[model samples]
Target: MPRILITGGCGFIGSSLASELLCLGYQVTVIDNLSRRGSELNLSRLLAMGAEFHKSDTCDPEALDKLNDSFSCLIECSAEPSVLSGAVGDGARSLLNVNLMGAVNSFEWARRRSVPVIFFSSSRVYPYDRLNACHYRETETRFEFVDGCSGVTQAGVSVSMPLDGVRSLYGASKLSAELILREYALQYGLPAIINRCGVVAGPWQMAREDQGVFTFWAARHYFRLPLQYIGFGGNGHQVRDLLHIQDLVDLVVRQVAALRDRPSDFRGDIYNAGGSIRSSLSLREATEICRRLTGHEVSTASRIEARPSDVIWYVTDNGPTGKVFGWEPKRSAEVVLQDIVAWIKDNASLLKEILV
Candidate 1:
């Protein structure tokens, strides 16, 4: 088995991937800053599972330089993932440093060693204004794309979608990183692959208002906390596709194997990894599901003011991903919700320390 290093490995997606890779007999090492809430707990879990961990910030190239570069692959998952990030105070600097500079340092390390890298990008790289301008109809529970909408279909938004408008600071940082990765791949001959992923949800996600909305909503319902349907007339019609961490790991494993075994076969450098229409969920629908799963109900208020750069609807079109990787999400929305609900229930005591 190949030894792998995962930056941000204590994060929801990164930690989940680490667990899966370890189970598959890969020698995994995780490096995380432990800055986020519940990250220490996640780190402990990874350590107990036999994953070597380095408590350091990826933004500091010096910190990353201290690590041994003996790993076969680097999974660069470190980032300030909130779209609402960088809107205030030092957030702007933090977002850029973590999402862009952190990636740069990682790429530099990989470049020096000629190591392969798997970069985890985001769907937010697509323009926010263009996505908002998409033709769509508001239904009772969610928004559906109207016929003749360019760059959109019943399946969802494709990579061909325009990248012309404001994509928020967070998105801009990730997009910038993706561009850098492309340059590195071409100029340095780095074996790099980028996956512009959608909403990734599953156990151990310390969801907050700005990021990890899926787990946040589930936790709110489980804890009987106040919930709200903000923006879009507060109808909770905004839609997004949810990708379970397990399914994401499956695709990642396959990608790593393909890159290792048949590098030439990895045609495209970028793929939109998500649930497509199969796991799409509206806020209203998600609330209902959480209610059922947790056996708890809390009144959800409505607010008319939408967040900056927030889109009304987004479902990833995984067509290109499936064609290139022969992979599709195996987990449904219900199953994803059930797993989150169960995790929250099991860790309610610990979660209250951080989530509440």
Candidate 2:
């Protein structure tokens, strides 16, 4: 059995991946700061599931250097995962430290140990301004791209889209890290793979306004909390695609196996991974689904002011990813929401303290 080390393994995506890998008989070790809300709960769960836990911060190179255990692979999941992260005073500095400097530390560790790395990047690396400027028409429930749009496809925004505009500071950090990974792969022959993921949601997510929108919406509806549509004239029509955590883990397992089995065949460095156009939902559509599932009638309001880096429509095109990995998201939006609802209900006592 291979040993896997996951950074930020106490968070939602990291913990979920650790749980699945452990269940599949891999030796999983997790290192996390447990700084985020609800991370302690996730950490406890992972510990109970037999994953070794280390309370450490990735931003500190000294801390990373002190680790003694050897692992076959590293999954870089530690991030400040919010588009609005660097909009305020100290946020910019913090974002750079965690997202950029942290990657450097991970890459350095991988280089020294001669191990492969699986990086969890975000679709936010795509320029926010350019995505907001996409040509689209509004329908009854959501926005649709105009016919013959240059950068978009039936599958959604492709990997070939322009990256010249302003992606938020968070995005810039991630993109910088990606470039560094590429250089390391070329110069040092480091086996690095990047997954540019979008809107990954499921249970165990401590959802917030700027990240994890799906879980945030579901939790708000279930708790009868106020909901709002804040951008694009506040019609609740902004769109995003969803990918379940299980589906993401499935792809990661396949990629990790291939990396160990046939390293030469996994040539593609970066692949856009998400549910694509088929599993996308607008805010309005998501609201209705959440309302139906939660049986709650939460009052909602609209504000015409748009948030910084907010995109009106974003559904990732998984074509390139599927072509390379032979993997695509299997969970539908409804099924994903249903799963979240069940998880929330099952753990209402714990979630209420954090979610509400």
Candidate 3:
């Protein structure tokens, strides 16, 4: 059996990946720094499932060295969780250290041994500001992509879109890592794949005021915490296409399989792995769904200031990714929301850490 190592394996996406890979008969090793509450919980679940765990930060070479690198592949998932926090300048250093340098460490270590690697990238790397020219329509409660941006066949945002000046500090940091991954693949003959995912949501996300919108909303709705619509503009119609953890893992697995046979095809590149246009939803719609599902009202306060460089509607085109991995999102927003609500309602105590 081929061995695999996952950095930040205790994260929402990472944990889901670990579980899925274990079921597929691979020797899985999870490395997490345990920086977030959700991550620790994920690690606990993985440990219960008999997956090996190393409580170490990926940015630290000493911690990474502890792993038996005889492994065939590595997935870098560890990073500072909040893009907003990183945007605020206070969290810039942490973002650089964990998000950028952490990936550097993983790639460097993997390159030295000729191990193939996969990286988790965010859609924020796209020139979100340039998307302002795209059109959108507002509904009774939320917004939807207008024009050619709707339906499953709509071919969401492609990788070729210019990534010039449209990212927050968090996005910039991830973009830096993506470039480095590409460079390393070119220089060292190490096969590398960068998956640019959007709003990856499932169980085990650390819901907070600053990040993980879906999980945060679930927690607030479950515990009746204060939910606020802080000046995002429109009827709270900022739409985000969400990708389920399962679909994302499937894409990664496919990439791994393809690389195993033909490494060159998988190296030196980036792909947008997202939920496509049909899966996109707005804050207003999400709030209404939460209210209808839980029989609780979602909080909404008109914003005094609109969020910065925010796009009213943007959807990722997965054409290239589908061609590469033959993968697409399988879960509907309703199904994902149902699962999210069920998990948080069942694990109510997790909200305490979430609010903090």
Candidate 4:
């Protein structure tokens, strides 16, 4: 088995991926700053499960320099990981340092070692304003994307989407990293794979807003916590596709296998790791599901003012992706919610302090 190195391995996705890889009998080593809530817990969990960990921050290039290992590839998952991250106060500069510059450091390390980079990018890179301006229709239950929108289909937003206009600071950072990574792949011949993923939800996710909207929604409902529909006429009609963490792990597992067995075919490229329409839901729909599963209505509030950084409707078109990875999310929207509810039930006491 090949050794795998994951930056930000204590994060929701990274930790989950590490867990899967460990189970598959891969030698997994992870580096994380342990800054995010529940990161320490994730680190501890990974450590107990036969994964190695080091306290490292991606913002510091020296941190990457000090680490030397014979690994198959570097999985760069470290980021600010929130769409609203830089919207207020001093978060803008911090977001850039952690997201953009941090990625620069990661690419440099990979370039020096001639190691491939498996980047966990974001769907937010597709320009915020363009997504908001996409042709959409508001159904009674939720907002839906309409067909014939340039760069979009009834299925969802495709990779061909234009990259014009303003985007959230978090999105800008991710997009900048993507462009730079592409250059590195071209100039340095780095084997790179960029997964511009959407909302990923499952157990052990600590985020309650912006990035992991599905997890946030599920946690709020499970705990009977206060819930607010903050945008899109306060109806919770704003939408995004939800990918299960395991589905993403399965995708990466195949990717790593491909990189090992078929290196020639692994020419650097980007793909959308999305849940697609099969596993998507609106806040209104989410509330009903959570209500049914958790048996809690929770306090609900509505806000008419929409966040400038937020979109009314967006879903990743996984059509082109399947041609490459032969992958599609098998979990349904309700099944995703059910898994979240189950995770919360199992760890309600510990999660309440972080989630509520």
Better-scoring candidate (TM-score), 1 or 3: 1
lDDT of 1 by residue, 1-356 (tens): 88999999999888988998999999999999888888888898889999999989888888888888788888998888899999767789878999999999999988898778899999998887777777788878899977555677888888887787888898899999999998988877788889999999999998888899989999898888998899989989899999998899999998888788766543328889998798999999999999999999989999999988888888999867886677889999889999999998898999976765
User: In candidate 4, what are the lDDT values of residues 1-356, reduced to their tens digit?
Assistant: 88898999999999999999999999999999988988888988899999988898888889888887588888999988988888988888999999999989988998898888899888888877777776778889898887545788878878888888787888889989998998888887788888999888888788756667778888888777788899779988888788988899889988888777665565468898889987878988999998899898887799999976888887878866777787888888888889988988988888888876
Q: After superposition, how far is residue 63 of candidate 1 from its true place, in Å?
A: 2.1
- lDDT per model vs. reference: 0.88, 0.87, 0.77, 0.85
Model 1 stretches astray by more than 4 angstroms = 264-268
* TM-score on alpha carbons, each prediction: 0.97, 0.97, 0.93, 0.97
| C-alpha RMSD values across all candidates | 1.3, 1.3, 2.6, 1.2
lDDT of 3 at 223: 73
Question: What is the lDDT ranking, best to worst?
Answer: 1, 2, 4, 3
C-alpha root-mean-square deviation, candidate 4: 1.2
Global fold similarity of model 1 (TM-score): 0.97
Clashing pairs in 4: none
- lDDT of each residue in 1-356, candidate 3, tens digit only: 78888998988778888888888888789998788766777887888877899888877887787777689888888887566756654777877898888989998889888889899888878766666556656677666555542222235567777666577778888899999999999887789889888777777677677677877776678777666675546357677887776778888889878877888776668888888877888887888888877888856776746565466665677867886677778987777778788887788786566544
Where is model 4 poorest over a 10-residue stretch in terms of lDDT?
259-268
Clashing pairs in 3: 156-316, 156-317, 157-316, 157-317, 231-303
